[model samples]
Target: MEDSVFSLIRTKYNTLSPTQKNVADYILSNSEKVILLSIGELAQFCDTSETTVIRFLRKLKYDSYQVFRVKIAQELSGETTDSIYEEIGTDDDIADIKRKVIQLTISSINDLNNLLDEKQLAFFTEAIVSGGKAIFIGVGSSGIIAADAYHKFLRLGIDASFSSDSHIMSIACAHARKQDLVVAFSHSGESRDILESVELAKEGGAKIAAITSYPNSSLSKSSDIVLLSSSRETKYRSDAMISRIIQLVIIDTLYVSTVLKLGSEGIKRLHKSRLAVAKKKT
Candidate 1:
């Protein structure tokens, strides 16, 4: 529920009329600032009447502007600390950047705690443990995250693999069955190739789980479980810098949670894994 507002916006945005689109665009582009403003102020900024803003909220399934803003505040409050957008100025120093990074890391951790549904996460891990195979899909930086998650699960003895190559990923997913799990990653949840692969896996009956910044993203909608992350954005682009870090944090939590759930046998497996790697290093 902490992120339901975002999911709602994404789900309803395309369905809005031209007038609502104006309000939706303004709200999405300036969510942080919107949360801080009065409804009348927001209506004025969007060049719409007060009634339109209220109507937009209702269309998104929120009761009123007050309710919508409350959810937005919660969403923004969970963003990585370093994500506070600050303009580059002539007087800026290294300390400013350092402080921002520290705050961002702390914010990411807190956001992970707030945004992640522990029960849902645990169910996802359980699915992995019981799964016959696990396939991870992503592109770019998210591809790397997917690969890392694949390796983590592999080391823990879950059958897992990842592919950055879209063709290969699609082919691999085509072979997955109902007992398999496909964990896809995409910050925007709008990645074409990733979505295609997810569609293939679903048709094949594979259970799905998605890690994305937007809970309402297409990837999230298609998956059985969704994990949300927070990030800072600039006017033109939303960088994955902080969001990826938050995603990795969630992965770490999942790995550790799995270890705990697996108990003594899990510890034994981990020890054996460490020794095996150490021997290979020699």
Candidate 2:
């Protein structure tokens, strides 16, 4: 319910009637208090009627307000503790945790399938496949994405580097040449260091790609390509876990597509690199 509902609204926000859009925007922006608001309260806050809210819920597959509220409450508390598979009298049932995780992953896949644009994806694949070199920049948990992207590109026979440090990324970008590509990872797309790296790469005549939650964010606007991901927030867990998982999935897809686009040459290079790297281990 947390992200499945939000992603539905995001994908269809442009197509929604004004009233429905109002409800959607309000819900997305004020997600923390959604469980606390009654249907009428949400309608009042969103400047829409109860009908619009109900229709919105129905579109998200909720049978009624009560049902939706129960789900939201459970999500807020980190999932239900009163299930048959759950330990009795616990704050959270093990099955509930597993269900939430599975649901979040499923929602991510659905969001990616529905939201990814074929033309844009193809363009990005071509850019990456043809680029001379690639640099990945990320901070905090997003740094894991940068490192993973670096390895994926390396496996594809592309020369790629990653920097978790802001200063190091700037230095790398300063020397980046045309045909080089820079990719930035940020959950909110507002990370200042990642933005700076994109700017530096642009100044150095390098193409840029951004993986982020907000398509309208600064990082997205500054980049040559933007890959979108959804982040689900539960009360007990930060959005980073969901965001990172989605980021890795998108990166994996890009890696596979890059290999496909490069044909046999790419495959050969991949094998050579693996064997060469493995030799060092032996």
Candidate 3:
């Protein structure tokens, strides 16, 4: 089998340029050898320039071409679909656990590209771009993703902050208004504290957006928009593991979308923010 690397690219075929399309065509058909191809080798094989290969990778949202190759190799290892998430039994071996986590996280992210809705993504992004103040709420694992997201928005000069503590989120909701945005991050979508704060913000007329697994859960029901993600099932539900990785992927997607909407101004703000802190790096 060629693995999903072929189907994934073909799904986005029309969007690729002439050069990138050629590269995609070659890769999709030759996915087996793609694992061993470097960026230059790939470009040569496709009769395109290295720059074209990189641009193709950028369109796929990969940080670097190397990571893209690694993902392809992982996919070919035969664990993308079933058996991606293995049960952590009482006597699970270290090697098996490592492979399970690696395959599961990759599979989770790949599934997100399909699970997320384009219209909903655009609607919330439009809201954020239209001067909507945002407050992100999450606890424990979700909290870390929210915090990182908060930092990204802060650097881009967006009016947003992350609140993990129940008390702080409640306080923030008290002051929230109709035009503000309340983002609830929960994998299970059943957090009592998150639901309570979401309800409070909803009463204040804030535009609520939720990033959670269950679309019919309280957090989802209370929110004006829900950005759904597929949470992998495991023996025990824990933090800083598989689901957190999916949450972060969602966060990065939103951050990139926001940056694209903000355009040049967002880039300048990010550069300036980095500069302000760069002096402290000594």
TM-score of each: 0.73, 0.73, 0.69
> Against the true structure, candidate 1 has what lDDT?
0.78
Error of 2 at 159 (Å): 1.8
TM-score of 2: 0.73
Highest lDDT scorer: 1
Residue ranges of candidate 1 with Cα displaced over 4 Å: 1-91, 235-237, 280-282
Residue 63 shift from truth in candidate 1, angstroms: 8.0
Better of 1 and 3 by TM-score: 1
Per-residue lDDT tens digits of candidate 1, residues 168-202? 99998999999999999998899999999999999
For model 1, what is the alpha-carbon lDDT of residue 47?
Answer: 90
Expressed as tens digits, the lDDT of each residue in 139-246 for candidate 2 is: 999998889999888887787888999999999998888898888899989999888878888998998888887777899889888888865545666666777888
Q: Give the range where candidate 1 is weakest over 10 consecutive residues by summed lDDT.
A: 80-89
List pairs with backbone clashes in candidate 2.
none
Error of 2 at 62 (Å): 17
Instruction: Give each model's whole-structure lDDT.
Output: 0.78, 0.77, 0.77
Better of 1 and 2 by lDDT: 1
What local lDDT score does residue 163 receive in model 1, on the 0 to 100 scale?
97
Q: Candidate 2 regions off by >4 Å?
A: 1-7, 10-47, 50-90, 280-282
